[model samples]
Target: MTAIAIDHDKPDLTGDTETQNDIFLQVFNSGDGALFDRLYRDDAISNFSGEPLTGEARRKFFVEFIGAKPVLEARVTHSYVAGDVALIGVDFSVKGTGPDGQPFTIEGKCTDVLRRVEDGRWLMAVDRPVAAGGLLPE
Candidate 1:
């Protein structure tokens, strides 16, 4: 496992599975779209909007999401690793003001898959959030 990068310019994602979530939070909270993009692979999949999206669709969603400046807090619940692949479960909430200028909060359990790339860095392969049983207070 590599040390976490202090400079956000180029984050080091070679830590253990659990540490990956922490690093993710650090980057996500930074709101740097370009740096956030480095956390995933070229073909990564994300269902941040409750719909599985990849390619341009995913890019668009994230562009708006980062632009929104949402605040995300997450705790890793569990993680499993086998060789180069890792599965991580996280309980999280994203709070922010929507485009309508309404304050909103979304809570969910996220299932993430990460793979150790050729450079020995762990990058997210998949990210899917399962909605919580009840909606957050409006």
Candidate 2:
């Protein structure tokens, strides 16, 4: 597993930034539906690789992606929160053999927006990836 190096100076906006990041890492490394239930709102929306996702669609996307290529590692390069919105920038890589028997790896950066609900629970509102050397897809 590759070690993800997080910048020590990154602001922990909500005082629970580390906790939230850890939860996200765990959820990605393990295809745990319960984690999804905790981290994403019912109306959560995500854009990845040109696809728009929401609700169950978003949940399934995470589940399937994690299931297929168990995250080898992830690092939060930057993170910030203002008011009820949190933006996290992460660098991650997944290592695994594809169904075609070819080894595949994807290294990319993701900017995830988390919103604090009325109940004070944080849930992902937008999760988008901007691949290195490629245009940001919507």
lDDT tens readout by residue for model 2, 1-40: 3434432233122336666667667556666543554466
**Highest lDDT scorer:** 1
Which stretches of model 1 miss by more than 4 angstroms? 1-11, 133-138
lDDT of the candidates, in the order given:
0.77, 0.65
Structure candidate 1, residue pairs in collision: none
Q: Could you tell me the C-alpha RMSD of candidate 1 in Å?
A: 4.1
Clashes (N, CA, C under 3 Å) per candidate: 0, 0
Error of 1 at 118 (Å): 1.2
Assess every candidate by TM-score: 0.85, 0.73
Least well predicted 10-residue stretch by lDDT in candidate 1: 1-10
lDDT of 2 at 57: 72
